[model samples]
Target chain A: MLESIMHWWEKKQYRIAPYLFISPFYILFAIFMVYPICFGIYLSLHEWSGIGEMAYVGLENYLNLFKDGDFYLAFSNTLWYMGASLIVNLVFSLILAVLLNSALVKCKKLFRTIYFIPIVTSVVAAAIVFTLFYDRDYGLFNLLFVAMGGKPLDWLGDTSLSKFAVIGLIAWRWVGFNMVYFLAGLQSIPKSLYEAALVDGANSLQCFLKITIPLLRPVILFVMVTTLIGSIQIFDEPYVLTGGGPADSSMSVVIYLFRTGMEYLNLGYAAAIGFVLFGMTFVLSWIQLNLMGAFERKE
Target chain B: MKRTLLLILVALMIMVVVGSSGAGAQEEVTISMWTHDNLYVEFFTRRGEEWAALHPEYKMNFKFTQIPYDQLWPKILTTLAAGTGVPDLIGIEISAFSRFMKGDIAEQALVDLTPLIGEEKEKFLRWEPYMHNGKIYGVESALCPVVFYYRKTAFDEVGVSTPMETWEEFTQAGSKLKEKDRYIAAIESSGDTPHHFLALYYQQDGAIFNSKGELMAEDDPRAIQALQFLQEGVREGILWPTSSYFDAPHFAALKEGRVVGNYMADWWSVYYQKPQLPEQAGEWRIQLLPAWEEGGRRSSTAGGTGFAITKYSKNPELVFDFLHYTYMTKENQIKRFLELQYFPTMIEAITDPQITEFSDPYYGDQKVGKVFSEAALQIPVQWQSPYWSEAIQILYKEAITPVVADKKTPEQGLKDAISKIRALMK
Candidate 1:
């Protein structure tokens, strides 16, 4: 029996070795990601309170979600955040990346570290600081506005401006993150391309428009897709800052889902919301990629 | 031969160590608890030591974990679902209590504490929130009777005497304060929860749900009246429209004397006011909440927490004994009051001299405890419903904000909120 086992092991070691080496990641992915996705689908079809027996309710949760006014509000708010963050973060990060990539810039490392600090800062600590800064009465923003003879604005209280308040926080934390990606993309572009454009008597704007942007398409698409995903699922900034308040004006889809599942104990409804969010994210991302010509022939 | 002898000697040593540890484990009863508040952990730890000392035969090993408020409930629920890693005991906040009682989980996940509490149930000031289907699930932590906290200096400046007695008088005092560019109280216009509204509503016998857990906010005329009172107060600029309470803007407003009055539970004085506004010592005073009618209910319960034993506990009886000795006993209840300023739910403890006669210098050397204890007996019950969290969210969004913003009348706003909540219930 020992000889037979040894013979089998010798025969299969080469084939099994590779699987053993890569099995950890696949095992973890199955347990965490795949299992959750499957379970979420099953949960969406049931009525559960997270602790009790799940009663299968078929498509009721989804049907209810379709008519849910709060869900629509949260959906619209999340789309607004996605569009705003994508534009604000991408534009600011691209500008910073271009400036930092320029030879005219000095102390590049120091500037990079300074700009990156907010990304590394604790969201809770940053939120506390921002709360003080956004205070309607004594906030720094209002204080400065008042000094400049402008009316004091309720950064977080007003329903119209609460979304912008959250957007500002999102921009502050994420601009640096996207900037790093753009910086890498800029560095990867050969210096010869810019030199050739310069030799051809193209102005800096022309060179940037024709050469730099075209070369950075992949990175921009990557950033746009990520920013879209991140903004749609935003929970921390709005949660810690405005708490999706002033009448759910700043409520994000993830915050709504969290409130449904954790706070209200509507696990089935929350799971339905989650799947809807996933579907929305997938459709948006696909459309975004298609618009960026990511699926076109690469040759 | 020497190697074999060495192995035997090592095995003997391992056996001794393992045997000793096994004996120790057999003697010790490990009890684990989870709470969101560190203060509770300290209270429990102190009580645990005393309990252990009193019961020397049963060696107790207590483990207390303090989780963040937002994360703790999810953790507890997940553990309860998995039927593993659940603590022997849990501290359930009053707001989250409804979530736990929804569906069959209340019975499956928690021990029926009714048997343990038995006749002692009558001794608690409030048990409605922790009770479900005629069975108690948790031990009440506080009476949480709401009181009106005001700045004496601000009131004196406006010539408003103590105990405004009626909401009409309170509004008049607010108008007086408004002339000096100050507001009497801060009304939260965009608060995440409808605490201000709920407190006043409950004071007038308004409840979101009836005792039978039926939706009744729309039918409750007092709820509309309470909401209109807030809207009118804000419209007249007599009440400051704060973004939220216990925040930077609210504290800044308080410090600058832009707002003076605050209505909250007894714990607010010690937990938030004294600690947050220590410089305003001796300037604050407490009184029963102003009644809607001249002699109506002056106090309403706002917030509370309860300790409960989990069904998964290996020794639930032991846990109950510990809770009874600490929370149910009058002596420890008074101790909790003196140490933590968490007004006790124990009826006997509410009238104890140590609790009622205690004076706080922060509130102008007033017998703060006495005022709260007096109100404790009159605190209106806050019934729990599965739709509570959703209802509060809807109440703030569809009702309070639109009403306060003058986009809708109180009647219209509340009607909309009720219809929305009812739709959700379907």
Candidate 2:
């Protein structure tokens, strides 16, 4: 039997060994990722409370999700943060990345490490610190304002300002991480391109607009699309700080999904919310990619 | 390859078979419980440690775990939904209980506890929140009846006396104290419900959902009146705006005497004040909640927790027996109070001379237990639906907040909240 097994193994190893080597990941992915996603899609079509029989409701959950005012509110709030944060964060990170990649900049490693430190810090801890920073009476901003003879403003309490308060913390934690990606993109560009541009009649600004910008197009598009998706599905900062308050103005799509699925225990509806988010991210990313002509270039 | 695969499969099967078949009959019954309350775990775990070895019919191996309050709901929900990994026992908070009991999930996820509660049901102080459609699915270890907690120092300084009988008197006292820059109790226009809205609205003949299981907050005249009264107090500059009572800033304000009045449960004195504002000892006192009308009910239920046996539990009868042994008995209830400061839910425990005679230095030597016992027994029973959380979210954000922020009238806000909630239901 051992002789026969060894012979069979020797004959079949080339054909089946690679699949056997990678089988564990496939098995795990099927169970954890693919199955739940498929089950979630199935759940989106039904009315379920995470227990009992899943009542088939066809498109009812999705239909209701569309008409629900809170759904729209959460969507808009998420978009607001995404739009504002994306613009400021991208511009800031690009500047930092370019400066770090510059020839004159010394201690590039130290600067890179310092900028990336917050990205590695725990999100919850950072959010807690930001919460204290936004405290109405004792917060840093209000304390400074008070010292300057201005009244202390309610940062997390006011509806108009709370979203920004949450957004600021989000940007603070994420900008460094985004800059790392830009840094990689900056480093990847051949020095010859810049040297060639400089050698021509082009000045620094001309070289930048003509050479650096176009070469970094793929990376910029990559950063922009991912940032848009991540910011839209934001949950931790607002959840930990404002708890999607003072009037649900800071609630994002993921927060709504959490509230519906977990707080309300409406798993089916929450599943619908999730699918809607997926659809939204997909469509928006597609639109963004097309707008940027990301796919137009071979690179 | 086939022989090697077959050998591996056979070995795995044998291992699986050996692993699960180790337990025999007449073995110890182990029940695991999950909760967000730390003190409860400590008390129960100590009780189990001492008493577990004494059980003859079956040994007790009780495991109590404390999960974080916010994450507990999602953890419980996901486990219950997946129909696996559910603990033998779980505690659901009062404001959150309705969320679990909202739909068929209650029936499917919970072991029907009616048979266990039996004729002793009347002994429980407040349980309507743990029931759904005439079925009792859970039993609480503590009763958190809402009462008016005021700072004696502030009220004495303002020359306002205790035991205000009606809303008129309460508001008048608040307005009178406004002269000293100290207002009445602060009402929240944000954050979780059952903090301000639930306690006040349920003080009278008012409910978010009517007896017919209909959402009536927007149209229920009593609810509308309650919201209007709360908004008016804030508008009148009598009720201080400290946001939610649970927030850090509000806790600071409480210590600073910015808002010296609070609408809180009996547990707040021990669970919150003793821990968070210990320096304010000997200056706070508990009184009956002000009546909405003359001679009206002065008590309502706030945040508390009740343990429910999950349907996933294998030995529910055993789990139930252990639960009853630890919680339902009078001796243990009193012990629970002595150890954890949980306000006893059982009538006998509450009425015990040992309990009612308990005085608190924080309340200036007042018998805190007497207030809890009196108010606890008087808390009104109101039916609730699982959709209460969703409705409450809208009620707080769209309805109640707009009124308090002076952006909308109570009527308009309520109307909008109702419409918005109705849209969510669809």
Candidate 3:
């Protein structure tokens, strides 16, 4: 083994081969990621309101963040949105994947494609479609609701209901995508384990509980981590739908950061918000991992 | 590897040689101008060629960016912050011109065109927002005054005679019009724009900022009265559902005889009374905004924009001359008024035979030019300081939008707005 390793190291291309393979990622990362992040942190220390001399505010922006009531409202809204969406999406996708995995499901490819259509559709186009869907007066949704003896719900306008409307949209677009992942994990489960459980006179549901779920632990962890990260960075849907109002009821943390940096032209304050958002995301994700681990071990 | 490196080096050397070779050559000075309207691109492109013909030695380099008014302020501010490659000429709105004027942002970043164009201060009327410390910074380009456009058929159907002057009569007529299965007015909602509240407040003797530049909307009785009028209008079912006025259906609704009147600025006449609505062409009439206190004080803001030379411009002289020729010149002003239906800012354009001679087929050959010109002169000028945008946004968002949404009472909303704005001012 030592002689073979020496032979491998003696190969002519060994010195440059690894670096040549990784150079693309390194170059792109340096240009796009590393430089911007360093510059953004530097920008956070100064008071630059899009004009004139840059006053050295140091930690003033972070201090101001403590008092900004709007930031708190936005923070709570983001948490509520993420919490609600995660619960809804996970349950719905898992149920969907299980149902699709069953033998009764016909033309599975066609059904999958139909379900996946919304995921691939342009966000702006979907937003416009949802705008019509949420329209109070002449909307098809209200028409159906009114026919069923229900009052016409102002889905997009009402501050309380607006988040649900946006979440419904998020779930609509992402459920199929997440379902595919779950389905792959389900397929990857060892068939003999389920068969052996069945040999012990266990039912299909029992076998799934006893073996399938335990096998799908790694997949669930991957999905949970990814979805959590994606949901926390939610910007476009809330931005296009509500514009952070009817009194900021739907203002996500990212939307607030955008308004600070772009609209209010306070880049330093925006950067401070960015760091706070990063901390929140990291802490919440760690908690999610711990909870998921507890659930995994129980199974 | 050496050959490849040599090739890359040779290319770089050639590019540098080509770039520096033109340094000692006759320099071409390009003036960058940013405009919000897409129509400006067409207007400037044509004018640029003409200007270029007049001065062959200096190329008239034009840079146009279409930024809508809502997003213009933030984009301008952010671009300015980048501290590189800003448009030398930016089309500043009358509403937002003060924001730049307040801080040394414009003062430091823009050229003092006073020395070059200061001799002709009297040539323009009312220069508060565009000038700082008695120095001319911007040029007046367009006039935007609020005008009342009512459906003639709706008026005749309601048996209301031409031109109701008093607020009570206006309200009564609006109520009467609503009674005939017609909406009283298709006014823009306060939630979207609270500046209408300020306009209505001013019409009712309310002032936004007090003598010491303190925001006084909350305790100001006039603001309360104005909000009451809006609330009353909503209560009386005179106002239609909140919808986009610019949408073609809104115009079609007017033509199909749904809505009676719309309180809109003169700029709207271009889109509203057009060949597309030839059937309703002869049935529309323009009138002055209804007096808030029964003809007690028929005064509001003199609305329009003035052009300014940015301090960052390498060619201030060229930009000032462009403004003078295109906007300030009586001949070009009349030409624009005739072509684009813009109410010219020049005082002489008001009385010029060119304006009086024009007839718009859209308004059934009504002398639109003469009407707008008269209204432009009578418009009351207001204090436009640098803090106006921040103040207005605060007032609109905190006070006006909340009241309109019924989140808070008009009094409570205005009070909140005042308190919030006071904090920002400090």
Candidate 4:
């Protein structure tokens, strides 16, 4: 084996072949990906605005994290949003997917495209469109509410309702994509199982629970894990809509971190906040996997 | 060999012909100017036409962009950071000049215009704010000192006299209008809102960020007191509660004579209120802000941009010429400001007969020139540091607006803002 390895190394053609083939990825990755990430981490260790001399602060930035109450508020809000989106978006998507899967449904592709249109649309554009719908006095929703004798709400202004407004936006934008996943999962289930359930005097609900859900477990787990990650990183909608305002009531961890790093120029504290967010997400994902028996299913 | 020789001979002849043609031709230089709005394009084009008539050898190309105010600074900073493909001339906000000074990008990017100042220095009376380390880096386009424009009808109804001098009297008079179901003022607490909070802070002898770039006003008693004053209005339901600036409600309310007063720089007069309200004309009059203390300052300057030549400019002399022609000349500056309502920084134009004699139909025949000039002279010159933008955001977000909304206690809010400022300063 040693002699063959030595002979292979001696082969100039083979030696140059692998290097030439793989060099592009390594070179590009080093320059684009690895360098910036490492530089960002390094930047987090110092006190430098986008301009000026950087002062070496050691671990003071990380220490300041414990005292930063805004971080805690943002972190807690992130968890709250994740929980809300997971439950509401998942249930809505699952129910919609089931409804569309029924034989009673017509124009399947057209409906699918219509439902999927918002998901494909840019978040900035979608947020602007939703802003018009959520406007206070003259908005469509408020007009309808007023016609029904209900008072209009300051949708983006009131602290109590601001988070829900953002969650509503996120759910509306995302539920269709989740439904597509659920629909695909439902389609993969063989119709024979449902037919058998029907022959056994089982109702539609019974068939859904006993047969459809068990087989679609893998897809369900996939969606949950991805959604968990996505929800934790929520930024654009809240940033564009409320600007984390009405007194930072709707600020997310990513937005807070962005403010610290970019706007405030406190990269070190921002990095610490970033690490804390990373740890929380990682632990939560692990808990989810274990609780859902995801590992056991895969094994 | 013969065919190759013949080809070489033909190429040599072609090269000789091209060289002779190029030698006699003047070298045409194209200068790229990055500006915010296309509003200035016609002005610059008109100036370019004048410049070409004087000097036929050079061509000037203008590139104007209207980036969102929030986006413009960061984009410019990033381009400056990369040290490539930047415009030959750029405009920097007076409020944001300090931030650019702190960054290595602008230090190398800007041309030192000190030598160019000469007698033209008098053209800009408020030049100290845009200067750093005794070197002028930028030239002011407009003198944007803030003034109050009140509804004459509302004031008359409320029985308030012209030019209320003290904050107490101003607040008292504005409060009476509330009984008649009118807003005392349109309080804009929106994101990146500019009410010249820095000027207010300065008038009360408060500073946002100190020389060391640490937040100075966070723990200061005066800052908290200033915030509480605005909060009182909200609690009393005298000020508009919404966060948007000049939103539909604000506009509609003002149009219907429900808004008692509004505060903005001269730009608002030209760009918004005057141009939009032709029928409601002549019911508005301008005055300086009410003083906090009896002997305290009244006017605060808010927003303006200065033109600067980038180091990459090929013809720095020609760039200076354009700046002089548009900015320094009294005739051109006065024409532009009078036509555009930009409020020229030129001292000569401040008291020009054309300006003083002119009566705005929108302001009900009230003379605006004297009011603006008095306000401009009364403006408190504050240092525009690089950290001013960060300080403004913190002060507004954590202290001013939050206090106004009753979300945080004044002291607590200031503490949070100061602590954030301290962390940022590090």
C-alpha RMSD for every candidate: 3.0, 5.7, 6.6, 4.6
Candidate 1: clashing pairs of residues: none
lDDT of 3 at B168: 76
Cand 4, B chain, TM: 0.86
Q: What digit string (tens of lDDT, one per residue) describes model 1 on residues A173-207?
A: 99998999999999999999989889989999999
Q: What share of the true interface contacts does each candidate keep?
A: 0.83, 0.70, 0.23, 0.21
Off by over 4 Å in 3: A1-28, A190-220, A294-299, B1-27, B67-79, B94-103, B131-136, B187-192, B204-207, B210-213, B241-258, B271-280, B297-307, B382-390
Q: State the iRMSD of every prediction, in order shown.
A: 1.2, 1.8, 3.9, 3.2
Better of 1 and 3 by DockQ: 1
Tens digit of per-residue lDDT, candidate 2, span B1-426:
999999999999999877756543236677889999888788778877756666655666777899999989888887876677889999887777877776667787888899888998888776677888778888887777888988888888878878788879889889878888876787776777736777887877577776556776667777778778878898899876644457666777777777788888767767777787888889888888988877788898777788899988999987787788788889888888767768888989989988888887878899877877788778876666767788778887887767777788878888888887776665
Best by TM-score: 1
lDDT tens digits, residues B214-249, model 4?
456657877777667678877887776665555444
TM-score of chain B of each: 0.94, 0.89, 0.83, 0.86
What ranking of all candidate models by lDDT puts the best one first?
1, 2, 4, 3
Position B12, candidate 1: lDDT: 100
TM-score of every prediction relative to native: 0.95, 0.90, 0.84, 0.85
> What lDDT tens digits, residue by residue, belong to model 3 across residues A1-299?
99887788778567878898999999999999999888778778877756777778889888889898778988889988888778776788888898898889998888788878888899878976786677555457898999999999867656677788789788888888888888999988877887788889999888778787788777777777777877888887877766665557778999889877765556788998998888888988888888877445553
Query: Cα miss at B206, model 4 (Å)?
Result: 4.5
Residue lDDT tens for model 2, A1-299: 99999999999999999999999999999999999899899999987776667789999888888778788999999989899888867998899998988989999999989988988898889877887788786579999999999999878878888898987887888778888998998889898988888888789999888888888888899889888988878998899888898779888889999998888877889999999898889999999999999668675
What's the number of clashes in each of the models? 0, 2, 11, 5
DockQ of each: 0.73, 0.50, 0.24, 0.32
Determine which window of 10 residues in candidate 2 chain B has minimal summed lDDT: B19-28
Q: Quick one: ranking by DockQ, best first?
A: 1, 2, 4, 3
Q: Which candidate model has the greater TM-score, 1 or 3?
A: 1
Which one wins by DockQ: 1 or 2? 1
